[model samples]
Target: MTATAPLPDTAGLRSRFDAELANFLDRQDPDWPDGAPRGVFRTLHRFVLAGGKRLRPLFCYWGWRGAGGADGTPIVVAAAALELFHAFALIHDDIMDGSERRRGEPSVHQLFADLHARSAWRGDAGSYGRNTALLCGDLCAAWSDQMFHECGLSTDEVHQGYRIFSLMRTEVIAGQYLDLVSGVGDGSVASALTVIRMKAARYTVTRPLQIGAALAGAGADLMTALAAFGDPLGDAFQLRDDVLGVFGDPAVTGKSILDDLREGKRTVMMALARDSADRNQALRIKTLFGNPGLDADGAAELREIIVATGALDRIEQMIRVRTEAALAALEQAPVVPEAREVLAALAAEAVDRRL
Candidate 1:
C-alpha cells in the first residue's frame, strides 16, 4: 500500500463541529417552566457536546471533498448534523440494549434515572428515565433534520441530499427492528450478517458517504463506487465492535464486557460458536449465555467457549477479509487523491481499534 498522508486537522474539524452543535443547542428554547422539564434540554446539551469518535461526519466531510465540494461552512454544518442523528441512534440504542454507560459516563437514560432516584421523585425511576431519554433521542433526530436542511446549502442541494438522508433513517429503524427479532429467533450467521448490513454497514458508512456525495451533486456512478468502498468497511467495523463488546476492557471500551453475553446478543461470532460447539459446550452455552445475572466467572467461561470453538479467530479473519475488500475498492474508486488517502487512513482506524 502507498504511504497514506496524515489526516487533515481532525481536531480542528471536531472543534468546528462541536461549535455548530453548541450553537444549535443554544438556539433551542423549550418554552417550558423551569424544573426537571427544563433540565431535559440542559442534559441534552451536555450529551450532545459530550465526546464521540465523530466518524460519520468525518466520512461525510471527506465524501463531499472527494466529490469536488469545497471546504466551507455549508458542508461542515451538514456533516455535523450527522452527529445529531448519531446521538439519537446511540441514546435509543442504549435504551433498547439496557446499557447503563456510554463514553465512560452514564447513558442518557441512566443519567435521568439516577437523577430521579436522587431527587426521590414519584413513580418508577427507570420508567421515567427511559421516557425522558426517548424524548431526548427524538429531539436529537428532529434537530438533525432541521440542521441538515438549514445547513446553508442551495435549495437543490439540500433537496437532493434529503432523499438519501430520509432513506438512511428508514433503513436504520428497520435494521433495529430486525435486530430485536433476531435475538429471539434462530441465531444464524446469515441472520447476524443481515443485521450487520442493515444496522451498521449501510447506516454507519454507506449512507453517510452517499449523502455527502449527493449534496455535492455526485452522479450515480460515484454513488455506486462509494458503496463499493463503504459496505465492506462498515461490516468490518461492526465485527470489531462485537469482538470488543465481548473481550474488550470496560475502561477502554466504556462498556461492560459481560453486557453482550448477558443480553444474548446474537452476533456472528456467537452464532459461529453455537454452530461449532460440541454437545457439552452447547449445553453450557444454552444455560449461561443469556442469563441476566451472569457474573464475571460465567463471562469467562463463555469467553473460553467462544475461543475454543474458534469463533474469535473466525471473526478476526472475517474482519481482515472485509477490510481488505474495502481498501481494494477504495483504491479503484473514482474519487480525488486527497479523499482516497484520508479514507484509507480512516478505514484502518475504524477497524483496527483496541477500543
Candidate 2:
C-alpha cells in the first residue's frame, strides 16, 4: 500500500463506525467455562483489526450518504457488518491457500500451530492447528451473521442485502471450484472467463455496489449502471491483484509470492500462457508447478515464460480496456460529486496500486 497523502478529515465519521465494529467483535468473546478448551476469539479479533482498507464499510457509508440518509451508529454497524463477512472469507481463503501470514502477522492457522507447539497441546501440533483454524473460520462466518443481525436496517432491506450476500458467496465458491478443477483438466477460454466473472469481478466490486445501491432504494436503472461500472472496476481490481500476487513487494502485500505460484492458481495470466504455449512450453510449465523448492530463480523463469507468451500484454490490455469501460459508466451515471470523487479515487487505486 502506498502512503496516501493527507486529505480530508474523516475523523468524525470514522470514530463512531470503529466503535460499532469493535463492539460487535467484542460480543464474539463469550467467556469459556472452566476446564473447557478456550476459544480463539480475541486472537481472531486482533487478526481482523490488524489492517485492511475497510472498503466495504466505506462503500456502505458513501452509498448511504449518496441516498441522503443520515449517518449514525446503526449505519456504521451496517457498514461494519460487510467487513465481518470479508473476514469470514479471508480466514478460509488463508487455509485453502496454505498461507502463513495475514496483514503482516502470522495467519490464524500458523498462530494456532505455534500455540500448540509452545503450550504443548495434546496430539499432533500441526494437525491440531489446521483443525482449529478451520473451526475459527467457521466461527467467523457465524459471527458475521451476528453482526449483520445487529444492523438496524429494516427487515425488508436487510433481507435484500443478505440475499445479495448469499448469491455473492455461491458465485465466489463456484469460481473457486472452477479454479481448482481447471488444474485437473485442460484449460479452456470459456471456463476461464466464467470463473473470472463469478469469482473476482462480481464479488469484489459489482455485488458490493449493488448491495449498497439497493439498500439506498436505487431504481433498477441506477442499479444497472452501478453493475456496469463495477464490472470493469472489479476486473481491474482483480487483474491488479493477480499482478501483485506474482510480483508485488511482500512488505506491501503481506504474503509471500511463492504461495500463490506454488498453488498453481488458474489465473488469467496462467490460462493465457497455456493457450499460447507450444508443446515444449507446455511441458516446461507442467514440470515446474507445485515443486516445494521452486526457488526465486525458478519463479523468475516461470514469470518470464508467462510474459514471453504474450499473455501479460493481453492481460494488461484487458485491464486498460475494462478500466475505461468502468470510467465511462461512472461518467454516464447520475452520481453526486462527493461520492463520485471518492469512487473515482478508489477506482484509480484499485488498478494503479502497488499492493
Candidate 3:
C-alpha cells in the first residue's frame, strides 16, 4: 500500500495567491487609458480580491506539486492565473444570470448599476452598469491570458500550459452558451450533465490540473491519470453546488435560494424532479419554478416537489458515488503522495460543504 503524504499548508498557498494578485493589480496603471473611467479597474480588482475559496488555484498548485515540481514563484504565479480566469467566469456568469449578490455583497453589475443610479448618469442606468461590467469581465479574461503567459516558466512549459488554458477558456464560454440555450426548452438530465461536464468539471477541475501538470512537463499518461481523478470530482462539486443553490441557507451560501429557481436553472436535480413528479406536482413545479416573483410559499411547494420526487436524495447519492470514484482514482494515480492526500480532502470538502 502506498502511504499518502500529509496535506500541505493550503492556508499558506491562499496567502501567497492573495499577495500575487494584489501585487499584479497594484502594478497595473489604472489610469493608463487616460480619460477612461477608472471604476472598471477598481471594480475588477475588488471583485477578484474579494471573498472566494480560491479552489481552482489550489487545484493547480497541487497538480504541479503532484507532477514533481518544486515549490517556486513561477509555479505559484502560473497556478494563480487560474484564479483570474475564474474571476472572469464569475463576473460574466453573474451578468448572464442577473444575480444581484455574490459572496454576500452586491455583484459587479449591480454595484455599477447602483453607481449609475447614484450619479444620475445619462442613458439607462441598468444598461450602463451591464455594459461596464461586461467590459470588466472581458478585461479579466484578457488579463488571465496575459498573466498565464507572463509567468516565468520555460518556453516549452509556457507553450504547453497555454494549450490547456486556451482550451479551458473556449470550452467554458461554450458551456455557458449551452447553459443559456438549455434554459429555453424542456430540461433534460442529459443536457444538464453536458453543461456540467464542459463548464464545471472540465473547466473547473480537469484542465486546471492539466495546465499545472503541463507546466511541470508531465507526460501524456500522467495527464490522463489526473483527468480521471479531476473530472468526476468536478462533477460532484457542481452537483453539490446545485443542491446548495436551492436548499442552502443564504447567510451561509452567500446567495439567495430564489435566484436558481427564478432563473429556472436547468440543473440535474430539477430535471430529475420534473421527470419523476406526478401530474399535479409537475404542474406546480412548472408554474412556480421560473417565476421571478415566486414567494416563500411557492418555494416551499417547489421544494416539496423536489423532495417528494426523490431528486434531492438521488443527487446526494450521485455526489457520493462520484466522490468515491475520484478518491479511488487518486489512489491509483502517479501523483506525488502529498498531492493525493490534499486532493482527497478537497474532494470531501467540495461535495460535503454547506457553502
Highest TM-score model number: 3
Number of the candidate with higher lDDT, 2 or 3: 3
- The residue-by-residue lDDT of candidate 1 on 1-355, one tens digit each, is 1213333576788888899888877777654445655767888889889888888998898888878777888888999999999999999999999989998899999999999999999999999999999999998999999999999999999988889999999999999999999998999999999999999888888899999999999999999999999999999999999999999989998989988999999899999999999999999999999999999999999999999999999999999999999999998888888888888988998999977
Alpha-carbon lDDT of model 1: 0.91
Best lDDT goes to which candidate? 1
Which has the better lDDT: candidate 1, or candidate 3?
Answer: 1
Query: TM-score, each model?
Result: 0.96, 0.89, 0.96
Q: Model 3 Cα displacement at 41 (Å)?
A: 1.1
> How do all the candidates rank in terms of lDDT, highest first?
1, 3, 2
CA lDDT of each candidate? Answer: 0.91, 0.74, 0.87
Tens digits of lDDT, candidate 2, 217-245: 66678678777888888877888788778
Which 10-residue window in model 1 sums to the lowest lDDT?
1-10
Report the C-alpha displacement of residue 50, candidate 1, in angstroms.
Answer: 1.2
Order of the predicted models by TM-score, top scorer first: 3, 1, 2
After superposition, the stretches of candidate 3 with alpha carbons farther than 4 Å from their true spots are 1-8
